[model samples]
Target: MIISAPSASEVRMSVNKSLSSRIAFIVSLLIVSVAWSGAWAAGWSPAAPMLGPRSLHSATRLANGNVLVAGGFYITTVWNFPTAAEQYNPSTNTWTSAGTLLRGRRAHTATLLQDGRVLVTGGESTTSTLAQAELYNPATNSWTEVAPMISPRAFHTAVRLQNGKVLVAGGAPVNSATNAAELYDPATNTWTAVPSMSSARKQHSAALLGDGRVLVAGGYSATTPFWSSAEVYNPATNSWSSVGSMSTARVLFPLVVLPSGKVLAVGGNSGAGLPPSVDAFDPATNTWAPVAPMGIGRYVHTATVLANGQVLAAGAYGRDSAELYAPATNTWTSAGVMSSTRGEHTATLLANGKVLVTGGSGGSGHLATADLYSPDVGSDLGSALGSGLVQADTCAATNDSTPACSAGSTAPDRSFTWTAPSSGTFTVSTTGSSFDTVLSLFDANTGAALGCNDDVSASTFQSSVAVTLTAGRQLRIVVDGYRTRCGTLTLNIQ
Candidate 1:
């Protein structure tokens, strides 16, 4: 948990100023986890239990670094159910009961509004699907009923749009699949009917693209089919149109938008049944490509994008397993496993640079256990923090000395070193403000280009480059600028 840094003279001005204080904070936070066994295998461990089990629920990160977990069934009794809510605090590794919902439900959706409130809508209760909607205020830890959707739904998808309104789409209404879509405005706390989808689907995946439209894909349909067809919703016009479909149709798994602007469809059930294969879709081209397959076949698992640009997938039913995907090489590598086997569990990426994976259907049944995924850290791993950006030239004190790169720009370049893995492939993922930044991977001992994002196709940032690590090897990552918002990288072994 100790993160030692170079001597003060060797540190960047930005990193040195608050270095001691930040180090102390990170170290302190690291010690908060008391149950560190199986939790560590999942890369990190969860610090505390929320008031309830949250399978098939939704958790949204708020602007303040707190996560709002809402609306999922609580297995209170075989004959009764509990409608509850909670919030997780990373700084304290604890959970506090947030509030009670209007209805006891599961498979609902929650979206964090730009104003910092959470809007929760629709899920199935023991008795029926619900059309009720409510808003939770983190500051007050309370909930207020909002306008309900036109359709009672469970297993729907809700995404916040750039325009500031939330979009709720297809799921089961009452007992059948639905093609309906609705929009919720926090400004007025009202719901408006929108153009219905071309398909009736439940358990489908939806993502807001960079262009401000919603990309809707794969889910189960009543026609005895799992759909591969996909569509896009134009918020400006309140309409939907067919887009490219996934290579394979899946439901109850995960589809995440990568930092690179490509959508990754991973680990889900095809109509044929659950499949372990992962695929990537490029909206620019509306095409799909086969990438790596997950080490474990999982349906009902969770996928989260880390700040460093790697996607972490955890918790399938029988398996207490998890894995990381590096889009750079279109490959998958096993990650540290979770403490408990979970399906239909919730995994959320908290604002504090750690992922909080919580409550789900453990193999034995509903579970209250939770865990976290801490990116593996090592000297080599630290070296990866600098990849994917441009660097300026450096001037030495004398002509005989090697010139160094210039310091302090909006996108300050990065540099790091890591010993190569003995028998596995390794990758470095990056995040920075420069939209078109460049990445270069170099042998740490000798500055040689091993591979790079620039060497790949255009528009590749938030990417990874795969190379086999020798018994003991090191690599350096460099960004050509400074002053960027996000400029971190993660090293992965697959």
Candidate 2:
């Protein structure tokens, strides 16, 4: 639910249903082109390169639409992992040094906490396996060390729970796989041990299911069969149970929940080599079934769900080719190719319908290059609305909120700057979403915060705010999530 607002009454908005309907009509036209032409229009384009070559780095999209790239091995004379971090600004198409972590780390997981801070968990350094953990504040562009994990672990998986707690499970503790798990409470800045996995696993995959349970699948285990087994963790019970095993045992695969509530286990490795064999698990049935194979086999690859409901499988140990999986037909199709072959890399889906792929080892070597894959090249708001009175009815943006707004928020904010078209009152709402959202209107040019609405009368999980606009006035709208809620935002604006 949205945090309570301080205002006694809603602003002077008359609830212009007609205006909102017109905006929806405008958005429908914008997406009609997408339906006709298909989303994957443009291929790969090079973005500003990172300051240093990196591989196995963690890239987390901040609440304010910026990406944080941190902790990866770079090649100079030899491979070296640096604690330094960098921020990527999509608006400016440039990279700037964000800050530095307390210690050099690689293979760590950086999760955006419910309160907008980044919790960086265990990763290894040149000398030791790391039990150390840290927090990154985007506003301060600095890192703060937090309570360490129970043990040194790398190649582990961490997912934010529905209740704002973090669940970290399955990774090598010192040298081999461990089933040990722990919970990190952001409010307490503390960690407590939880039930371990049914099996000790490393290099596995985990995803939050629709029911709030986490499904972890196929990874290397201590015993030997390279772990084809799967398990599900129930937060309510604080335990894990064996689920249906994948048809083929594999490690280093990606487990992702689809829009249909089905979980996909994509390309990965068994004992021998990377296999293109793909599988999907139906939560409703508690069973696993093989699906269409990827065009090519890839281990250490990445799968990202597109706005169009297709999944893009990109990069592998030696392959640079990418492919897309369409659930409608249960088929795989070739996507664009990246500039460099990538393995142990990261692919993050940006709010603008593009995938941002960052540093990894490839055919050339470890890379610092970044690539933006636009499935819908014409999806940019500016392209459709162009210098207009109103933009699209619905749009997606990462909140990437500043430190100032994070005080009561677990989600980041997305800011929109526009010149007012007419002098009148306007109503902005997040009525369509299923999660709590915060809406604020602003004087964009002066950087002044205007009215803020944490919740609307219609729903606690949604927000609506009204503010008057003057012709030619510089306006900005910031949509922030109330807590740990950052995903595609179907924002409604007038």
Q: Which candidate achieves the best TM-score against the true structure? A: 2
The segments of candidate 2 whose C-alpha lies over 4 angstroms from its true place after superposition are 1-41, 377-494
**How do all models score by TM-score?**
0.70, 0.70
Instruction: For residue 396, give model 1's deviation from the true position in Å.
Output: 33
lDDT at 355 for candidate 2? Answer: 84
Error of 2 at 430 (Å): 27
Residue-by-residue lDDT tens digits, candidate 2, 120-232: 99988887878899999988999999999997889999999999999999887555889899999999989999988878888999999999999999888667658888899
Query: Which window of 10 residues has the lowest lDDT sum in candidate 1?
Result: 394-403
- What lDDT does model 1 reach? 0.69
